[model samples]
Target: MPSSFCYKVLVCFLLTYSVQYMGFGRVELNAQEGYIFENPYQKTEKQTDVTSFTIYFNQKSSQIPKSDEVRLQSVADFLNQNRNYEIYIEAHAVDGKNYKEDILISEKRSLEVERFLLIHFVEEGQIRRLFYGNSKSPNRTKAHAALNRRVEIRLQQKN
Candidate 1:
């Protein structure tokens, strides 16, 4: 059995959630100091969380840097555990205005990443490679070229 105040809080919470979900209006709690209004609807623990590593590459180089070498083990472990998910390796390089070189380097970068996963015993069937090279970039400035020189790894569920 719940107390009257607890029951009232539950009712208020449900009403607030329902109204917010339907785009009606937001409920202002006007909470006081020392009182933390935590969201009860959200998960208290992370859901099936897998480590996300930011794998970066050197300028015009496909070799994985020493800083990111250690993180690849965690990625391999996760992929091995989640056989239903496929990992995507998207490789990119700095824009040198030479499409041929850019494409070649990017393809090499993706293969390098795939090689690491393969060495760790992750199934080859679970990997997808996409090489964008210099065709795609966040910016055209030399200062931001480092941002483009990298590989992005993503996981997707198998159909």
Candidate 2:
């Protein structure tokens, strides 16, 4: 009885904090799926995941794509409007080099994106960098390397 009660209390705490701190529009707890946080920033359309953006990079290149200029601008605008949210700049690269080289490449890309965000007036404190070169690739196959070489801008609520 005590163990079950403790678990219930813990689950409640998680649900509350997940919604409160993460700005989750809705939070659901289930034994099979665990905690699911719905997108809070979405206004008109319902999304399966959290509100975020992704920017892809060219092979061995860190320059922000011209086509993604609008997307980055939108991110900057959102951050400027919502001060309570911070962005996780997740960098990924294809596995074309040794482990260290892969990481370095990803780091360079992450830095470039950071600079872009900073120049756009997003608070320095609001940007966090996470570089995972090939290690976290969704697909490592040659054909999918292009998909791995990318940056994902994800939002997390300020604590």
CA-lDDT, candidates in order: 0.77, 0.81
For each candidate in turn, give its C-alpha RMSD to the true structure in angstroms.
Answer: 14.7, 18.2
Query: Per-residue alpha-carbon lDDT of model 1 for 8-126, expressed as tens digits?
Result: 99999999998879885667868543222234552223223344434667777888875455566667898899999888888888745588888999999999999999999999999
> What TM-score against the true fold does each predicted structure earn?
0.65, 0.66
Candidate number with greatest TM-score: 2
Off by over 4 Å in 1: 1-53, 95-97
List model 2 lDDT by residue over 1-159, tens digit each: 999999999999999988887895557855433222333452223223445867778899999876566567777888899999999999998845677888988999999999998999999999999998778989978998888999998987899
Backbone clashes for every candidate come to 0, 0
Q: What TM-score would you give candidate 2 relative to the actual structure?
A: 0.66
Clashing pairs in 1: none
